[model samples]
Target: MLFRLSVIIVVMIALVLSSTWSVNVQAQGGDEPEECVEFIQQVLTDLGTNCAGGDPFQGCASHPVITLDIDEEETDAYTDDYLGLWPIAEDALEPEERAELDPRDRFPLLPAAQVDASRFDLANEEWGIAKLKVSLPHYPVAADQVEDTVFLAVGARIEDTTTPSDAYFPAAPIDISTTAETALREAPRANADVLDTAPSGVALAVDGISPDGEWARVLFTTNRLGIWDLAWVPTSVLDPTVDTSDLPEVEQDSRVPWQEIFLHDGYEESDECSLAPPSLLLLIGPDEDTAVEFWTNELYVKVRGATLFMIPPSGNVLMAYVAAGVLLVDPDTTDEWVIPAGFWGYWCLSEPDFYGGRVPPEPDEERERVIVPCADGAEFVRRLPDDDMQAWLAALLNPLGEEVPDIVETSGIGGPTIDLSFNNSDAIDPVRDACELGQLPPDICDLYEFPS
Candidate 1:
């Protein structure tokens, strides 16, 4: 913010001190573009007084957006700052001047769409990477402050999130091969039931490594059902050339924990109302001695030089739209989980065990696990849905005053929210499991074919 302000200030100061300064400002043309010189002078002179009023926050808000015309003789001098569009000047002013001007009479800033295109780079272009920027300050430090105090972005939300139990990591699996034919254990231990023997050369996918680094949780087809499923194997049997150091650590029940970014579920807000951002991204810029954590969501992830997007806690899942650089996620008391820049990570809350096609845990011994481990877990796919994505992108890329796309309309009920729900079932793909699992509505589920 200061960088752009300094550039404009330098240009403004040079113009003011130069021989042409008086000719530009003293011109009696009130409505002419040259009058912008007068506007800038008034703004620069009053910046200190207006911004530093009794209540800085309220004081800054008192100054409304204003459009000032540049001196046509000097338009080329600072035209680039205007970006070929009218620049809305938001500077402090005297109480008398504030009451004289009707804010509505002034021109608006560049359309949010045009401005977003030039500024925001959500994880849209590449996979799993969005940058969360910051312009928030705890209090007013200077009167010449030109930074944005409203730290929220359009698609981001922040709310009071409770501290979740323990650390968790979603299943992030990739295909590999069994180094040698070995018996697949029902659990990571060698004495566990042998589900099957994986051939020495056959392909399999492993999602987790055991705490002791002695075993791995692998998913492969079994001879009985021939359906893709999960099993455990000794880590030594996995391809030695590949690295398992970064895979999520396995817990009991072959479950991968919901570790990274544990957020509260749903659009629910808390009565305490501390406002911990259920969705907004923050650039903490943490140092080695930094003390504050963003919110109480199990893990405290301090990232440097990378962007992470925390998704709205929906469908009982806490997700992060990943960024394109290597992000290190560290929990205070556990081994770190490394999410390669290309993959997204989330923590899904387990429901009553019956909901997940499994038996319930003992009341005193319940644990949080993914409902449908692989299906609900993240999968690396070759193709992403581009058409639907482009529709979402339209909101991100449209210029000011352009009609918004039919999708992603803001639902005004919750303060400035985006309606990301899918109303038309026509666009939904007929995932067979979604229909059989009762995830889709009956009418929509009936569109897909299922085996008798």
Candidate 2:
């Protein structure tokens, strides 16, 4: 709690220090915020911009990391405390020209990766330490096989707070609709279970599409079950007018790992942050039906083309499967409980300590940190509120270069989890009685009406 407060204090202080923090936009001749003014007035301190030691494509040198395909070889991009990332020009600019640069050019969202609230008084944002975000035409990986589908990364958009436990494929919105009555299925194939039948005009929101573009992952709230589900529906139902150009094509049988394994190596000495929470890596599979399995925090997990939020053992390890995704949380290695996306599942690694046992109260301040096993202190599963999910997604998709907040926690929302916690995985599935694999019975499924 204190850790979160401290970060808030840092930003509040920055906003307080900034003269034009409240200004709608910075107008020429108008007084800008101190942070913005200092960005240009003082030597650029952003780690991403400097040549000595900073993020990719240093302001004064050729590309140190991946060679960008951008028009400008060397571009100047810095972060300000108040305003997010400020991209000026490639070459040196005259003071007048610098002043002429529109303040709106700067991004508004900041990353949670390199959060430092203690020194909000510091000069620039991305203080030479923020993780680099870059676009790689062909990202080189350690392994040999690589394709455009790999999204093959060079740097950390999918990285996490602790070592090793990080990464996932990018996720785009699914606010598309159906032109005619659609059949939601259990899998991408025609023989799959018919989960539900939607009306002709029914609009649907889904995430990824099948590799062959024949299927889409759709979420539906069944009336019989009175629960939301993660199921597959044919792409043919999509409204012709809905623009799905932005949708990322799902890679069937993905070669990419949905998430990296946890090293079990605890936080470092320099990583102590009173209580600033570690960021959770929430992901939907890049593939279609095949489930991706991996090891982390002494637990084995299974997930198909579903949305799962994982905080590896390195940092208060939390594995939560949300809304319309299925995540298998198996600690004992037993036949895992199939945690239905009907209700979100939270598997705990640590009980009292939220941030992987870090930032416990002041009395335990001197205690040594260790990787808390998921079975030890974890409660297995808990329900997460809707607001928490929204805040997290916003940070992940922040247009300001994916501003991942170090702590994407919701405060003042009563609490993180409600009083209800699932006893077993079977208990978590709301439709098991009336529906099997989202296959609805005519007697129960057809009775209720869904929103358009």
Candidate 3:
């Protein structure tokens, strides 16, 4: 009886182990789409890494690396294919000269040719980078073929940040609508008349105007968002073209010049203050869906500029996608147009200094020389490699009575955990330090439970 009981007990233990092994295998098994796998492989290849160590699933690493893949064929289409459609004399056409054509006749239409799909290689590339693959429809062409302008529709797939093991493809193509010369002539009429008046709450200033009076640039400040917006439009539509004979005698009231339009924080003005060049300025925003819905039939065009479209702020996924598109087309100057640091705020048109009075409190001293903790629990000490220790100490000590938290450590919890420690202590007063603290806002400290 004892021997029989031992045999049964051993069999039950074996079964339990087998079941556990099966569960693990299933967990590691990747059910992701084959195309997604190909894309990830391609990105890894581009980054000069092998797929073995980099696979999101079956790998030991916690965070998957992000990678971008450009559709070279599509990129080439934008660069080479679309350029072919430009009228040889497009640059030479005067505003009036181009305006003579029918509005429908002036639209830039894409060529009817099909793009070769094979040129987009998402798989079999070198490894170790996360992958993204974008497929886009052929450029749109007009039925009449009289207009040789091109419109492109692009689609993209990116690895999901929330579910790092999976990927997502855009349901719709991002549309790039081209403007006609006639439409350009009609842009200025849509401006708000109050734009000319500098009201108490909203400040408006005109910037550059096109020589033909077809376009005008303007800047406005919004109190709510606490930022300035600069926009360009056709002038004929903004205000009735000022008759030269009846023009105002005041110098500042005269047509705004592009060079003088940019606002500077101080008296010192330099070339850096200049706006981006005309060709390079593609005004995109208010978002993709908004742009399409509004522009499709609305009498007034609210959003105009290169590729302006709305996208969700999470992971800044859309911004990264648009940035990639812009980069692929204009490789040399792509970095200059990277998305600004703060773009999620609602855009408002108002006057300068509307929210200028609400500037956040200045940092307190002693907070300066401290080593702060980063998201990863790593210490970040800002030391000038070229300067002597005494110089650094002097800078840190000069501004006394400001609290600066210099050390950062992890909270020892899972999932985006972080903790801040000052000078290796569990509690320290930031204001007691000699240098001013910049990053740790009051609200953030309160949430993190930093000592008061």
Highest lDDT against the true fold, candidate: 2
Between candidates 1 and 2, which one is better according to lDDT? 2
Off by over 4 Å in 1: 1-176, 179-186, 191-197, 220-230, 239-427, 430-433, 436-442, 446-452
Please, what are the lDDT tens digits per residue for candidate 1 over residues 181-261? 899877777798887888898876776777898887776552211123457888787778886666767655321111122
Model 3 lDDT at residue 39 = 50
> Which candidate, 1 or 3, would have the higher lDDT against the true structure?
1
**CA lDDT, every model vs. true structure:** 0.33, 0.34, 0.22
For 365-423, candidate 3 gives per-residue lDDT tens digits of: 21111112223222111111122322322242233211222222333546444343333
lDDT of 1 at 436: 49
Best by TM-score: 2
RMSD of 2: 16.4
Model 1's C-alpha root-mean-square deviation from the true structure amounts to 22.1
Look at candidate 2 and give me any clashing residue pairs. Answer: 47-128, 112-404, 112-405, 112-406, 316-356
lDDT, ranked from best to worst: 2, 1, 3
